[model samples]
Target: MWVLVLFDLPTETRKDRQVATRFRKSLLDDGFSMFQFSIYMRFCASRENADVHARRVKKSLPKHGKVCIMQITDKQFGMIELFHGQKEIEPEKPSQQLELF
Candidate 1:
């Protein structure tokens, strides 16, 4: 299984930099590879391991920060591919449909 973790921190002041640094370091200690800056991570492990690591990462973050974890399996990746292949809808569709009423 692959787990992707996304997080954001409130940047009210310079303090956010320190907190973000600590959070990243904690994730690293927990054996998570950095895929992006507080955006994505890849962890190859079992579901239980992923959950435990995600919780630890969340706990290590600052009080004002936000974190989200998503576990992806092979089937989920296939679904993503299907969704990505869909065409985009025109922006005017909603208004045009409403006017028909």
Candidate 2:
């Protein structure tokens, strides 16, 4: 399974920018990879693990902006199509198989 987080936080004030930057750092520290600006994804071993990460994301969400957490199976995540500008780009591969839990 995969845990995907999408967020948009106000960055007008210095404090707001600091908060936003801290939130992004938290995601990386929690093992999420940046999928795009304000978007992050992490692979989990199971739905339970994904839920744990989803709740973590919820807890770190900024008070000023909207945040969304979604869970998808490995197959569904793998099915994603990708493109960069006018050229196609390879989508992210799922986590290595049979990783020691």
Candidate 3:
């Protein structure tokens, strides 16, 4: 499973910028990778695990902006296509090594 987090936090003032930076740091501390400036992604072992992370993200949301979360299966995540300009870039692939529970 994958937990995708997308957020847009205000940065109109110094305090707002600080708040946004703190929020981004918190996401990294919680094991999310920066898929984009406001988009973060993390891999979870199962649906329940994804829910746990989603709730964690929910609790960390900022007061003045929007936050969204999505949960996708490995197969669904694999089907995502990325593009830079007019070229279609290769999407991220799942790791091949088996994981021991």
Candidate 4:
């Protein structure tokens, strides 16, 4: 499972910039990695784990911005095609999580 957080926050004023920065920091602190300027993604071992992160993202949303939370299966994510200046690039592979009994 993958939890993708996409947001566009206001950064016109100092306070707005601070709030936006805090939001990004919170996402990083919660284990999400930057996928793009306004996109962050985290891999989870299960749907339940993804839900937890999605809830956390909701809890930290800024008061004056647009935010979206999306969940995709590993297969779906793997099908994504990336490019850099017309050259094809491979999509990122999710890190394997160690499980302990």
TM-score for each predicted model, relative to the true structure: 0.62, 0.90, 0.88, 0.95
lDDT of 2 by residue, 1-101 (tens): 98989898999999999999999999999989999998899999989888888888888888898888889998988788888888888886766757664
Query: What is the model-wide C-alpha lDDT for candidate 3?
Result: 0.87
Q: Report clash pairs, candidate 4.
A: none
Q: After superposition, how far is residue 25 of candidate 3 from its true place, in Å?
A: 0.7
Top TM-score model:
4
Error of 1 at 46 (Å): 1.4
Any idea how many clashes model 3 has?
A: 0
RMSD of each: 14.9, 1.7, 2.1, 1.0
lDDT tens readout by residue for model 1, 1-101: 55777888876677877777777788777766665677555545467766776777667767876788888764553344212248643321111112122
lDDT for position 41 in model 1 = 56
Candidate 4 per-residue lDDT, tens place, 1-101, comes to 98999898999999999999999999999999999999999999999999999999999999999999999998899889899989999887778788686
Kindly indicate the candidate among 1 and 2 with the higher TM-score: 2
Residue-level lDDT tens digits of model 3 in 1-101? 98999888899999999999988998899988888999999888889988988998888888899888989898998888899998999976544445487
lDDT accuracy of residue 93 in candidate 2: 73
Cα-based lDDT at residue 43, candidate 1: 46
Give me the runs in candidate 3 sitting further than 4 Å from their true place. 94-101
Model 4, position 56, has a per-residue lDDT of 96
- List candidate 4 stretches off by more than 4 Å: none
Measured by lDDT, the strongest candidate is: 4
